[model samples]
Target: MRRGRAKSIPKSQTRRPAEAAGEVARLRQELQEARALLRELAEGGGSVVAKRLASLEEERQIARGQAVEAAMAKSKAEGELRRLQAAIDKAPGFQGWLLRRARRRLETG
Candidate 1:
């Protein structure tokens, strides 16, 4: 009769539990470090995100003001054109005189 040999388990498998625990602890430490960095960035004077938001708001206000100014100027010009057209319709010779006066004023100014 031949003698039978016992099978042996690998050494790495035997040490797997401790290695896994160490890996978990290291990962947890890294996570804590990341969280701390985030907290620090948030608590400091100002973050990049906050600065960008402020700049964007300022630009938005400037754009809104410009839009209002443009609307007012357009309304003013339209009113002047209508008034000038009415005057020209009422007096045939007035349009040429008004044009000459405008040109003279522009040249002088």
Candidate 2:
């Protein structure tokens, strides 16, 4: 039998009490946001709500599509934004900004 060495985690992967708490807070905030969205969507039971839900679903499916496509204007940020936006429609104009802001919080905390 052959044995291999276990992988070691980097310092960034280390969990601290503050970090854990912050993560919990963030997750709770996310859950609240999701609940709010559900409530908003459920408020009206008509073609409008159904159309919005269908649009959101279509965005989700497009995001899941796997293909090798050329980048436009050689803009890498656009690609990343589209990928993240497709997955998260709430932050359409602020996807990249929000991601960077969250990273900053993690680094500062």
Candidate 3:
């Protein structure tokens, strides 16, 4: 019985030139497709962000208007309260009945 030695092939001969070229072309096509997808996503995402920013701006304006209105209403209410307090302080009380009676007599005369 005879033992045969296996032939050693070089690393460069492992893949043919045509096969390597085809692989390179396939990889390049995939890269182009990936870039196109990324561009499409970026454009779409920009619009979404813009719309969200606009919505937030509108909400902020509405909130500011409401805050201003609330402040004005509070100031008006405080003024009314102060006027009422001053009027009550100047009005005659039960302890000043004589003064009230004198004023009534003066008015009648």
Candidate 4:
């Protein structure tokens, strides 16, 4: 049997929590900015209540657009995750080994 040396993989092959956290932080900042802009638009001077209502409606439309963009971004991230997972699952002699290590780390700490 040719059960000799196994290849060692680099740590960068797997996704890290830090990257995910950074992405979340960045998205939060964007959402905060969008909200601030909407608030500004809604609070700006208007001659009539109808005008204010229209401005608020515009703000709502902006919020809806932001929500749709966020949804698309989430879908893209999920697709990327699925691609990575599929790649991991197809690797030889590594799927179960990696899963066990992940489970052990999660369970222990």
The superposed Cα distance between candidate 3 and the true structure at residue 15, in angstroms, equals: 54
lDDT of each: 0.83, 0.75, 0.83, 0.82
Error of 4 at 82 (Å): 0.8
Task: Write model 1 residue lDDT over 9-99, tens digit each, in one string.
Answer: 8886676778889999999999999998788777773776788789999999999999999999999999998896666546548776777
How far off is residue 9 in model 3, in Å?
57
Estimated TM-score per prediction? 0.44, 0.34, 0.48, 0.45
Best by TM-score: 3
Clash totals for all models, in order? 0, 0, 0, 0
lDDT value for model 1: 0.83
lDDT accuracy of residue 17 in candidate 4: 93
Each prediction's RMSD over C-alphas, in Å, is 17.3, 23.5, 22.5, 27.0
Clashing pairs in 4: none
Error of 1 at 36 (Å): 20
The total number of steric clashes, by the backbone 3 Å criterion, in model 3 comes to 0
lDDT of 1 at 38: 85
- Residue pair clashes in candidate 2: none
Q: Write model 3 residue lDDT over 1-109, tens digit each, in one string.
A: 8779878898867998899899999999999999997887687978867888999999999999999999999999999978855655566777356555666687699
Model 2: residue 12 alpha-carbon error in angstroms: 3.2
